[model samples]
Target: MVGAEQTLEVEGHPCVVVDRAAMQYRVVTSDSAAVALERKGTSFARRLGRRRNTVTVRALHELSLVVERGESLGIIGRNGSGKSTLMRLISGQERPTTGAVFASSTPIMLGVNAALMPDLSGHQNVVLGCLAMGMSWEQVNAKFSSIVELCGLEDSIYLPMKSYSSGMASRLRFAIAASIDPEILLVDEALNTGDAQFGDRSMKRMDQLREQAGCVFLVSHSLDTVIKMCSRVIWLDKGHLIMDGDPTETVQTYRDFTGHLAKGNNISAVRIRDEARASLQMTEVLTRGKSRRSRP
Candidate 1:
C-alpha cells in the first residue's frame, strides 16, 4: 500500500493536485521505563506480560485540494490540526499513507524552523543552502548579494547562524528559498517570524513570484496574515477540512469557531464546524490523462 502512494511531477502544468491524501502513524502505548524494569527481573518472575498496545494516529484524513498557477492558498487550523503534515505531503517531503500528490515542479518548503548549520557563518550557510537546492555555484555567486540584501543581513552575514536572532534566521531561510524562483512554494509559518518591514518585502517578493505564473501554499495561524496574503483559504480541524472558499469568509468562520472554543462553548464550536464542513464544495483534481472530483 505504501508503494502505491507517490509524489510525481507533471510537466508544464505549474499546479498541484492532491487526491484523497491521508497520513497515519502507529505508536506503542507501553511505558518504556516499565518495560525496562520488567526486562531486568529474574527469569522466574518474567512470565509473559500483556503485549503493548499500538494505536493509529491520523495526521491528515482524506484531504483533497487543487492549487492552480498564480494562486496563493492559505491553510488555517489550530495546533496539531495537520497543517504541517499537509505541507510536508504537498512538498513531497513525505508520502501520503493512502493517496498520491502530484505537482508541476518540486515544491520548495520554507519554514521558521528550517534547518541550517548553527555553527556556520550566515554567508557560508546561504551558499551551502542554495547549492543544496540544486543551484550552480556560479548562480549562487550571482545571487549571493541579492539574497543577503533581501534578508536584510548586512555585515552580520559573516557571523555564525547561532548568533542571530530567530527573525534573522527566518529571513535568511526565506531569502534562500525564494532565490530559485520556484514554480511551487510552500511557506509554513515563516512570515510570522519577521518584523513589519521585512513582512512588506516578503509580500512583494511573493507577489512577483505569483505574477510569473507560480503557485504558493501558505500555512499560518494568523488570520490577518491569511486574509491579507491569500486569495483562497481552507480551514481544517482535527485533520478534517472544514471549509474552503474566499479568504475573508473562511477565516471569519474559523475565527468564530475558535472564539467559541475559547469561551468554553464547545457546542457552538461544533455547530459552526459542522456547518462549515457541510458547506464545502467538491474539488476537482486533474491528473495526466484523467480527472476526478472529491470532497475535501
Candidate 2:
C-alpha cells in the first residue's frame, strides 16, 4: 500500500511537493523559521567614542519548493521575509548556509543599480551576457531581432547603457535574457523599472515564454502583477513560508501584512518600508529611488 508521503527540509523547514511528476527539485521554505532581523551589537572603537553597529541577519531555517516546467510562479513576503535570498540561492548566485538548493536550470537576477557592468555599453553587455549564459554567437544572432523588438530598443539598441536611463537599461537586459530562452528565469522586480507601456509588453512576452518554453520564478511585491501573470504564488515572512496557494490569496495576505506595518504594528516598519520600496517596486513605484515613470 502507498501511504502519504512526508515533507522534507531543504534549507531548514519542512517542504511537501504537490506535483511530483514534473519536477526534479522544488524551492521550499519551512514554516518554522525566523523572518526577524536579529542584530548582533558590535562596538567599534573610535578616537571620539565607541560606536555600536547593529548587524542584521536574514536567515531561512528550512525551505523547500518545486518549480516545474511551464509554471509562472510568484514569491511574496514581508520586508525581511527572505524572499530575495531564496531567489539568489535558487539561482545559484548565493549559497544557503545550511541546507541545499536544487535548480533545473540557471537563474538570473535583475535588480536596480546592480552594477553588472559599469563600463560596457548596452549592446556590448548583451553580447557578453549571452555568451556568459553559454549561448553561442550563432544562437545569439538567431534571437537578436526578437530580443530587440520585444524590449522596444530599436532606436537605442546601440546606446551605451551607462548613458541610457535606468529604465532603458532594464528593458534591454530583460529583452536579452528573455530571448535567450533559459529553462528557468528569475526576475527580481526589474519590470517595475519599466514604463507602463513597457510593462504591458513585458507581460505579454513573459506569457509567450511560458507558452513556448519553461518556467519563470518572479519575486515581486506587486500583488496585481502576481495575480494577473502568475498561476501560483508563494508567501514568505521573516524567512518563513507563511502561505503557498492561489496568487490572489497570497498577494492579499502580503498586502495586509504591509498595511499592518504602515499602521505601526508589532512589525518593523522602517525595514518593511525600505524593503517594500527597494524590492517591491515591481508591484508599485518606488518613491525614494529615482522618481521614475513615463510622462503622459
Candidate 3:
C-alpha cells in the first residue's frame, strides 16, 4: 500500500483522477551541498561520514492527491511549508525529486512576482508573456485590449514594468494569465495584491473559469481568502498534510493548532497533532458513481 493517498471530488462528480504510489526523496542542505570538495584519497571515507550528517530539508514526503475539474482547491500552510514548491511541480516548472505528477492539461501559475521583463513596457510584456505561454500572435493581438482593461493599467501600460509598483505587476500578470482561461490554474497570493474592486472582478472571472470545467489550485496565507474562494481545503504543516475536508472544518482545525502554539501550550498542540495524524485518510481508490464512469 502507498504511504499516503487521497481522493478528490468536484461537486458530485470526479472529473480529474490521480492515483500515485508513495514518493520519497532527500534534498541536500545548501551549506553542506555547496561546500568545496576538499577530501583527499586518504580522507575519502572520513569525508563520506561527514557528508551523511548534512542538514537536509524535505519539501514534501510521500504526497499523493487528486484534483478534479470544476473545483477550486485551496492549500494553506505557514512559511517553509512547501506550498510554492508543490505549485512549481504541478506547473511543470520543476520535477519532483521522487515520484511523478500527472495532469490533464498544462497548468498556468499566477505568481506574486511575475517573470515579466523589468526593461520592457507593460504593453510589450503582455504580448511577450502571452506568447511565451503559447498564445499565438494573432490571439494576443485580439485579446490585448481586454487584457489591458482587465488590468486597469490604461496609459500606464505603456510604461516599463520596472516603473510599476509590485501590486501593479501582480495585477498585470494575473490579468494576462486569467485571459488564457487555462484548464489548470495555480494561484499563489496574487489575489491579495489587488484592490477590493479588482478582487471582486477577479473572483467573478475565477468562478466563470470553474463553471467552464477548469480546475484551480490556490495557495494563500490568508485563511479567509481560502474559505471564501475554495469549496475544499487542505492543511499542510511541516510538509505533511494534516487534514483534508470541508473548508470550514479543516481551516478551523488548522487554526486551533496555530492558536495552541501561539499560547505556548505544548500539551494541547501535541494532542491536536496526534489526533490529526490519527484521522489522516491517505489511501483511497476512486470508483464509478452515478455522475461519471470510473477509470481503469
What's every prediction's RMSD, in angstroms? 6.8, 14.0, 5.5
Candidate 1, 136-240: lDDT as tens digits: 999999999988888999999999999999889989998887787777888888676688888888878767765664888889887898898898988888898
For candidate 1, which ten residues in a row score worst on lDDT? Answer: 1-10
lDDT of 2 by residue, 128-197 (tens): 8778768999987887778788778886777777687777777777776666555667778866768888
Candidate 1 off by > 4 Å: 1-14, 30-52, 281-296
Please identify which of the two predictions, 1 or 2, would achieve the higher TM-score against the true structure: 1
Error of 3 at 196 (Å): 2.6
Q: What does candidate 3's lDDT look like per residue over 1-296, in tens digits?
A: 11254333334333333333222344454564344342334366666677443433567665766776678889987787777777777887777766677778778887656588999999999999899879999999998998888788999999999999977888898888777777788888877768987788777776776666478888988898899889888777777766777888878888898899899997998798768756664223323242245434
- Candidate 3 regions exceeding 4 Å error are 1-53, 282-296
| Candidate rank order under lDDT | 1, 3, 2
Candidates' TM-scores?
Answer: 0.81, 0.67, 0.80
Q: Give the TM-score of candidate 1.
A: 0.81
Better of 1 and 2 by lDDT: 1
The Cα RMSD of model 2 versus the native structure comes to 14.0
Best by lDDT: 1
- The local distance difference test score of each candidate is 0.80, 0.61, 0.73
